[model samples]
Target: MGQGQPRRHHQVPQFYLRGFADDSDRVKVVRFGEQPRTFVTSVKNVAVEANFYKVDWLDAVREDLAEKLIGKVEDAAVEPLRLLAQHGELTVQQRGDVATWVVLQYLRGRGKRVDSVGLQKLMLRADLALGGKQRLASRLGLDDSAEVDALWDSIVVRGELADPPTMRYSHLRTMFSSTISKVAAAYVQAHWQVVTFQRRRLFTSDQPVCLWRAPDDDPGVGLLTADAVSIPLNHTTGLVIFPQIPSGITGESAPTTQYHRWFLAHTWMSAEELLILHPDDELPDWLPAYREARLGTLGLPDIQQFIDIGEAWRTHQDRSQPAAEVSF
Candidate 1:
């Protein structure tokens, strides 16, 4: 690569889920000027199945997301893959501290596990954390702190030190804070008009789209697009607030439930070429966040059930005809 060469930016398709209160979300037209200062925290989704289950502005976003999730594929096999990809990484929260997180699978899976220290220390390569100052100090017959600190000159200069071994792992993955919202925005832009559901259409102001698409684009918008390239984002922060005692509610009436939207920008890797953002590949700045999930946890009803099922399936496969002794 030449010094002046520009880094290539990929125009990848992206999607995200935005949730609204189920009751309020049932309506069609949403007033654009509602205030939401207190709504964000009060209506936050309670934990579900030991995991967070925020409501999506599903009614509003379904039109666009349906298309993005399914794509325009006709083949059944490819459609399943696309569906898998859409549902693949639905929820992503930090598995451990930002410094110790080493796996994307945990954060982005259909159901993610809560962050833990043992997980942080399990998946890392043995090299970056190995033979480090603490290890060196213990291995080279030197127990004193001053002596180890003295020998760490080169390591410290190279930006590798976890004094007293706090947060010895560094986050090797590159995380985009706006990753979820971006995907949502992309879906809106691509299929907003062409898709609809139950006699309702996506929300769009009569603001001229032609001007929004023109060239010599206004730099002030900070969101630019060439006919073939677009930098759209999803920064919607839609939420509702219900006071413990709103005008109509009495002690007999239940307090209203408000919905909070997680405001996010559309986040994605611009340069897919060299972003070294794998969870397990790099050691975190903290020493404790690394572990791999052995393949046994994948089957339903646990490992014992899976083994029994596997044995039965094998026996069935070996039979020439519908068998009388298939339980073996």
Candidate 2:
């Protein structure tokens, strides 16, 4: 609310989005729903929500703290991302910087915020089901039976009071401040590869980072459990993090199969629809696959079964449960 403070906060950093822009610095946006449409706009206008990172619970002087912190992360990652995009090379420190940026970006999206609220509601519903109304009321610190009954009805019957913006914002802040470092460390230790597409330009979304796992591998999806995580750095360049190097393939071998699966997963997770970085003169025939993928009817085979990749390296050698499912 202060003079010159940023009121429009971008979920996806503009510098990163510009990597997918055209000669005129505009990007194509495709929206999917009951009515789908396509349009072109500057990267500044997309993937942004007014005061998205504002911490309203904080004092006015520090309301934009999260935005300022996010800006620093984006600034730190600029050079490392450029190096990876241009030369596919980075020093160890640069790799860690980029990994940290990716982890934060993955968690800071609107989709993740929505997931956090949904998960909170789900856990409350589960507790109520298992512990009954009185137990749930006690857990919530409500001693009045009337208040407990009303709260239970709102959650169970009316389906209200499930989404609280302040609580969601607090959870997001906690994730960025507490959970990001551990996840980023795992990404730094994972198999890193730069993928360049000679003929096809890639699509990114409001949710840019894509986490993919083999349908049969594990139900959990996260940086540690996912067989691969990917993000398109530019129209032609992208990064894929795999659990390990495939058994016999050279480092140069692009995981094309994983790319498709990740693309599908990214499409499904997008808050709106796929972002076409560069719109083809004629709409590509494969565009339909985005919708099909979102519908779970894409019919891509279990390609991971043939990839022959090894197990993921864990941060703690003995801990189990696959690093706590950062992705849903």
Q: How does each model score on TM-score?
A: 0.18, 0.74
TM-score of 2: 0.74
- Over 60-152, each residue of candidate 1 has an lDDT whose tens digit, in order, gives 433233223222211222322232222222111210111011112112222222122223322221222333556657766888988877755
Q: What is the lDDT of residue 128 in candidate 1?
A: 21
What clash pairs does model 2 have?
A: none
Query: What is the C-alpha RMSD, rounded to one decimal, of candidate 1?
Result: 24.7
**lDDT of each candidate versus the true structure:** 0.23, 0.68
| Residue range with the least summed lDDT across 10 consecutive positions in model 1 | 258-267
Tens-place lDDT per residue, model 2, 1-328, is: 8999999999888898888787777888876656677789888888789988887755899888888888988998999999888755677687778988998987886666666665665555544554556666888899999998898777744447646756547656665775689877777777777777666556777777777777983465776677877787887777777754433111444637566445545644643444556644224464553341132111222322212221122223336555665776
Instruction: Give me the runs in candidate 2 sitting further than 4 Å from their true place.
Output: 124-154, 244-251, 254-274, 280-283, 289-328
Best by TM-score: 2
TM-score of candidate 1 to 2 decimals: 0.18
Provide the clashing-pair count of each candidate structure. Answer: 36, 0
